[model samples]
Target: MKNRRLSNLKYEITKNKSTLLAIIFLTLIILISIFAFLIPMDPSATNTSNILKPPSASHIFGTDELGRDYFVRTIYGGRGSLIVGVLAMIISTSIGVAIGTISGYFGGWVDNLIMRSVDVISSIPWMILVTVISIFLKPGLQAIIIVIGLFSWMETARLVRAETLSIKEREYVLYANSIGETSWRIITRHIIPSVFPTIIIAATSSIAGAIMTESALSFLGLGIQPPTASWGNLLQNAQSNLQSSPYMAILPGILIVFTIYSFNKVGNVLRVYLEPKVAER
Candidate 1:
């Protein structure tokens, strides 16, 4: 499996150099996030002497309005963005898998009830729903994560349900059912594993979505909040200084775009290789 994974990755990289570059850059970003504590720069500490400084020898990415280091803040901000992205993805994927598994495996009144709920939720504009929810709740990491997770699971639920419905009809699943395997056991042990590829595709897509949503919310002053460094909040803070300190906006903006593009490329690779339909296409 390990060798196969490497070979597959090598093939993917050879096929799309963008995917290769994306992986390298994303790996560097993740490493930076992990090792941000060791970096000797402060995001919140103000330095009026260096205010509005452009990219220079001392401050490579320059300084912001409060004279804080943009380079360090951008690096540290990645940690938060990645954390929220990962946490929201996990929460959404968990809820989606559970609801989809139950609805697909049972396929009765339970399915109807859950599917109806999904329909109702899907009927609403997702962004409006999330914005409204954020407005009702306090704007912070926790609130944003919960809102993104809750609102984003619908599509994953639908995908998982479809995959489960197809997988549950297979001979192995029917045999397991005949041998007196409990519904829960069969669903957990058999159905979930079968639909895992679909789940992964959903998950990969969700990471970028979560990051973008968080950024949009923060840009609107509804996510992560000030003083705390996040890509979104950084962008928010920089909006006023676009003319004087364009690096403040450009740095974070580039990071966000690059990160999303990387994930998308990686996800595309996963979709083509892991998904049979995609492979056929």
Candidate 2:
């Protein structure tokens, strides 16, 4: 089964040019972000003499208002953005899987209560909730990540709950229950493994969502403050220079769009590959 799944994934990668390119881009960017510290230039270091310089041989992507190395700053920004995405995804996935599993495996009042709460939360505009919560917390990468992760779990929870509902009804689950296995054991062993594919796809998409959310918050001045370069804050810093130094804004905008697009592309491909019914669509 593992081999067949791997073969399917390999086939999907080989068949879809966009997916392949997206995977390659994501891989390259991740590597760049990881090794960004090795670069000698300090992203935050400023030179008043070099401020707002246009793209040239020496300063690719041009200098920002602070006269920092745009190239280095952008690389560091990618590191921050990717970190927020990954950490937020982990937080959301852990919360979502736990709540979803409990809600679905133990149906009746528990399911109804949890589903109603999810519905209530989902009914509110997501951005409003996140923004309000963000305002209360001290602004920084950690605060932004926590806000995004906490609010971002609803969709994942719903997806997992649906998967759990189906998986718990399977014969293996029934057999486990009949054998007097603990509910926790059954859920951990059979249900979680069965629903894990869904979690992977959801988590992939969650990273993109988290990144976009962070960008929006930062643009609004409620996220990653100055001195720390995130793609979001890079764009935020560029807002005043749009007319004078369009590349300042354009570069970060391009990064945000392309990074989110690549993540979404990968997520969609995984969904189609892992869930054959989705592929049929």
Candidate 3:
């Protein structure tokens, strides 16, 4: 079954040129980030004499204001950025699925209570809320991830809750309930599987949002601190030298844009493939 699924995925990618390119870019970026440590240049090491040099044979992406290798720093930054995005997605998705499943499966006051809470939380401007919360926490990867993950789960929760509401009323779920299967078992065995595709679609969007949020936070100096090599902080560092060394800002900005764009593309493709009725629209 897994092999067949994998084969179908490959077929889909091959048939869609845009998705194929997006996947390739995403894969290359992920691989490069994972193996970044293998490269010899130290992202944090500074050379006062080499500061703000333009791209050259020795430094493909040039040097930053701190005289650190911009290429190496950007690579390392991707590692940190992608880590925060992926981990935060996992945290948000877990919270969303659990709460959504409980609220939907139980219905009545449980649903109303959960939905109202989601609404209350969603009313606040999340970026402002995340920024205010981040100010209290120490600036680092984990702090940024936690802030983004917590604030970002509401949408996913709502999506899952809607899906779960419809799924719980289905014949199979009704059959399970009639057979005296525990609510927990019905949710775990039937509802979750039914909602998994929705979760996947939400997860892809969550990852993109998380990465963009982290970048924004770091740009404001509230996220990963300097010398840590996050893409956001890299852009922050380059902001002062925008005229003298625009490449410094442009490089990381391009990376963040492309990464987010690629994720969005992949999500769209997945939505089309997974939800056939929507595709027909």
TM-score of each: 0.93, 0.95, 0.94
Tens digits of per-residue lDDT, candidate 2, 181-248, equal: 99999989999999887898889899999999888888888889889999889998988988999888
Task: Sort every candidate by TM-score, greatest first.
Answer: 2, 3, 1
Q: What C-alpha lDDT values do all the predictions have? A: 0.87, 0.89, 0.89
Query: Best by TM-score, which number?
Result: 2
Model 3 scores a C-alpha lDDT of 0.89
Better of 1 and 3 by lDDT: 3
lDDT tens per residue, model 1, 84-186: 8999999999999999999998999999999999999989987688778876898888998999898889999999999999999999999999999999899
**Which residue ranges in model 3 land beyond 4 Å of their true spot?**
1-11
**Per-residue lDDT tens digits of candidate 3, residues 44-113?**
9999999899999999989988788899999999999999999999999999999999998899999999
Against the true structure, candidate 2 reaches a TM-score of 0.95
lDDT of 1: 0.87
How does candidate 2 score on lDDT? 0.89
